[model samples]
Target: MKIGDLSLPEILKKTTATQGLCFDVGAFSIRLRSTHKNFIHTFHKLYRDFPVITDDQLIDFHIDMVIANNYRRWIKPQIIARIDGQQPFQAFAATHAMPLFEWALNWSIARLGQHYLMLHAAVLERHGKALILPALPGSGKSTLSAALAQRGWRFLSDEFCLVQPIHGQIVPIPRPTPLKNESIAVIRNFDARVFIGPLFEKTRKGTLGHLRAPTASVDCLKQTAAPAWIVFPQYQNQAEVLLEPLSKSAAFLKLASNSFNYTLLGATSFNLVKTIITNCDCYNLSYSNLDDVIAQLDVLSDNAQ
Candidate 1:
């Protein structure tokens, strides 16, 4: 479907003063009406407001969500996400929708042909260079990015990092971070200013909601951040902070594995990764304390100068 050409569905809610808020989900402008009476209903209304993104020449895949009875998600296709219960959809959708939107929109716009690759990595900008966190799921990449965004570093994305191959650089596409379970509370405790939405319950990934990314972060999309550092962060149960350097080859493999379209991008991806890993530094950072990690990152950033 032509997302730009698509229009939003009309919303029906008693308490809503307005029909909804128009959101640009890639090419699709999703309009959501907040009922206030039911937050989940508001999200659902927002979702279906736009025309269904069909499987076509431009769209590689199709995705939709089904919320049945407000208590259970009875049926949902592989493409359709069923985010039931009192959890945040941001976290649940980030792993799937975030990258998919990037692919679909990029393809529609034909911005980088089929060569652009996306990854589920958190990117932050300090000075002019970008710090790519190509870490595993359990890592506190989201938390660290959120804290940095709240402070000074421009938030490119909380869950996915878009890499430009020809230029051998990272681009910013700021969006909200989905904080699950304890992580939500952890972020809330650290800063009450966090904009957390309501949660859906009993989903496969547990309850969910999202912490909004900074608006200032999204405004710096034109500026390309040099790949100054690549750190694989790990969040252990109760471990002291450690920032050990990893072998360049190992880091390369790990980064390639985390990438969305590395295999498809072929030589372009290889050259980009080679250039990034060769000149930039790589490290393995593990921490249970955010303040400690933040402080250490400050020192590391300063040393880079």
Candidate 2:
């Protein structure tokens, strides 16, 4: 059954009691438990489409969100996230519990997902090919990715680019796209059909909001896309779409810098990254208009055939 199949009270009861909610989230199977009402509500809304399993299955990340039980509990309650019985982050206000848990889960994956060559980027696929968008903060990577996903490209992931080094294929890790600050509004206005999670105000990264992955994209989680384009995107106000080709060596260095486990993967990582750039077109894209950028990318991908 899907997570949305259960009512809110049913989810709360299951998590607070002995039976936990076990679900498949792309490459990982996560078992989550929480008693806080707000956290429960957000979890239900964010992952409504994910499949829930009742079997005694092995889970990669076992997480619990609990209210702090101290003097501060009376003053201002906070929620703590414990993964595998270890707390990795500082306690956050109870109001921020949902985003905190999501943040914690991403952290757990980056630290524990050692099998793949993980890059901190946004990725999407179309026509059996993947578009890897690796950029620094404020580059509008997430915003552009959300736009592309809404415009028909299959959403892979907005956070991590999971690449199978041996095969040079991009694995789908379709999760909610965390839209921050103004970008949240940008996406909301861009796509009326997109489902966005509750607004998280004053987060460390500023006000945060999450866009649920498209149902079709999540349903095809097992499908892998071949690396076809490595494009670094930047958003400049009032700037027209500017696409410039990058040399293979330059693309390699930028990709390596954005990778989470590139150095850890050693020669395997280096070779895989090289093969991707060699087989795909690499470019730097800057634009202000979303439609223009999307059109440009469509033409670029078509030319690669």
Candidate 3:
């Protein structure tokens, strides 16, 4: 069953503050327990396509978002996120519960999912091949990925590029892409069909909103794609679209720096990164226009095929 199959009351009933609501997101299963009404409503809408897992299934992470039991609960109203019975972050305003959930999930994946070579990147698939956009924040990674996913590519993840070590394949972990500040408007204007959540103002990352993962991408959660291209994307205002070829050696160093657990994995991570760099076409892409970049990527994919 899917989250959408249940009504608000039904979801509330199944996801009691005690047992939590279990759902499958790609390879990971999460049990989320929250009593925040707005958070539940928004989560239900954004994660409607994800598979609802039974409590009998093995859960990878147990997350709870509850109202603070202090004087602040009534004064300012704060929400605390607890993962595996441990509070990893300070309390956030009750209004920022959704962002807290998203960030907490990211933290859990990065810290616990050491099986894969996790990179700070946005991954998308086309014709069974993955295109990785690995860049630092404000480099237009999420925006570009979100745009590409809307165009034709299947979205894997906007935050993590999980590469299996042995097979050298990219794992799909499709989730809502968080759009910060101006990106919220950029995506909204870029695609009329895109569904963006409510604007969350004055957070640490500035005003934030999330783009719902495409239904097509969410449906293919189990599908994995081999790495074919790595493009380091940067959004520059009024800049002409440019895609410059990058050396494999340079790609290796950059990708290594972008990894979450590169040092921890050691030699295994080294070999996997080498394999990816050797096999994939590497490029440095800079653009101001989304349509132009999308067109260029389409041409690149077609020519490669």
Best by TM-score: 3
**Candidate 2 local lDDT, 6-122, one digit each (tens):** 999999988887557888888788888889998899889888888897649878888889898878889899999998889999999999998989888998899889999999999
lDDT against the true structure, each candidate: 0.60, 0.90, 0.93
* Residue-level lDDT for 114 in candidate 1: 48
TM-score quality measure for candidate 3: 0.99
Q: Candidate 2 vs. truth: CA RMSD?
A: 1.2
Per-residue lDDT tens digits of candidate 1, residues 44-71? 3323322333222253222232222332
TM of each candidate vs. truth: 0.69, 0.97, 0.99
* Model 1 stretches with alpha carbons more than 4 Å out: 1-114
Tell me the deviation in Å of residue 280 in model 2.
1.0
Q: RMSD for each model, in Å, please? A: 8.2, 1.2, 0.8
**lDDT-sorted candidate list, best first:** 3, 2, 1
Segments in model 2 whose C-alpha atoms lie over 4 Å from true places: none
Per residue, candidate 3 scores C-alpha lDDT tens digits across 86-154 of 999999999999999999999999889999999999999998789999999999999999999999999
Candidate 3 deviant stretches above 4 angstroms: none
For this target, which candidate reaches the highest lDDT against the unseen true structure? Answer: 3
